[model samples]
Target: MAVDPRGADLARLISEDPGGPVVMLNLLRFAPDGAAAYQEYSRRAAEFLHKYGGRVLYGGQGSTALVAETGQAWDAVLVVWYPSRDAFSSMVADPGYLEITSLRTQALSEAVLQATVPWPGFGES
Candidate 1:
C-alpha cells in the first residue's frame, strides 16, 4: 500500500528514462473519506504540475469494470503526461511540492503511479 514514491524510486525513474514525453498512469484507492482530501491536494498541486510541464490527459472516478477481477477496480484513475521522466522527478523533488505531498499520503490507502511509453511510430500517421 505504498502511496508515494521514495527517493530511490525517483532516481530509478530518471535513470531509466525512455526518452520523449512520458504518460503516467495513476490508480488510486482512497482511505475512508479521503476523496475530498485528495481533490484538495490536486488543486494545490496544479501549479507545480504546470511548472514541471505536466498535464492531465484524463482524470475520473472509476466505475464498474466490464472486464476485471476482484481487487482490480480502482477508486480513481489519472492519466498525466509529462515532458519527460526527468520533469516528473524534478516536480516531485521540489520543496513546495513536497510540502503538500502529505495531503496525498493521507488521502490514499493504496496507489499506483506507473509510466506508460508510447509505441514507436504508433501515433504517427
Candidate 2:
C-alpha cells in the first residue's frame, strides 16, 4: 500500500544513480472511485513535469493481463523520463508539488514506482 516515496527512498535513488537520464516505471492500482482523482493529479502535475525537464512517454489503462499472476494486473501504467535522479528528487521536493500529492496518495491503493536504466546492447555504441 505504498503510494509515495520517502526520504530514504529518494536518498537511495541518488546514491544508486549510475549517471545520465532515467525512466520511471509506474504501475498504479486505484482505490474505489480513485481513477478520477488520479487523473486530476496527473493533470495538475503536468506543469511541474515540464518545469523539471520530465515527460510522460506513455500513460494507458491496463486491462486483463494476457500473462501474469492473479494480483499482478494493475489499473494503469505510466512511463516517465527524467533528465536525472536529481531532477526527480527536486521536483518531488518542491513546495508546490508537495501540496498536491495528497490527491495521488488518496487515489492509489498501491503503486510501484521504479527507476529503470536502459540496457545497451553490446556493439550498439
Candidate 3:
C-alpha cells in the first residue's frame, strides 16, 4: 500500500481547508518490527511539527475494538493538531522533513491520515 501522500493528495488537502486549526487523525498498521523505526521518525518529526505550529494531541497503540469491520484493526493511532492546513502542508513540504519521512513510510504497512473539522455545536445544545 502507498504510505506517502501524492501531489494530488496534497492538493485535495489544501482545497478542503476549512480555515483555522486542523486536527489530523492517523490510523496506522505497522510492518514487522516497525514500531522502533516509527519511534525514530516521531522523534525527528517533532522538530518539524513544532516549527509548523503543530503538536501531537494524542498517540497510543491500538487495543481491542468493541466495534469494527474485519481487518480494520489498527496498530497505532495518533492525533496531531496543526495551526492550519497550510502549516501542515508547509511542514510536509520542508526539505528536511521530507528526508526523514522515509522512516515513517518504511514503518507502516498501511495508514489513514484524515483531517478533522470541529463542529460548532458538537457538545452544546
Best by lDDT: 2
The 10-residue segment with the lowest total lDDT in model 2:
116-125
Estimated TM-score per prediction? 0.95, 0.95, 0.95
Task: State residue 115's C-alpha deviation in candidate 2, in Å.
Answer: 0.2
Model 1 misplaced regions, further than 4 Å: none
lDDT of 1 by residue, 41-112 (tens): 999999999999899999999999888898989999999999999899889989999999999999999999
Please provide, for model 2 over 1-113, each residue's C-alpha lDDT reduced to its tens digit, 9 standing for 90 to 100.
78999999999999999999999999999999999999999999999999999999999999879999899999999999999999999999999999999999999999999
Q: Ranking by lDDT, best first? A: 2, 3, 1
lDDT of 3 by residue, 15-114 (tens): 9888999999999999999999999999999999999999999999999988999999999999999999999999999999999999999999999998
Clash numbers, per candidate? 0, 0, 0
In candidate 3, clashing pairs total 0
Model 2: lDDT equals 0.96
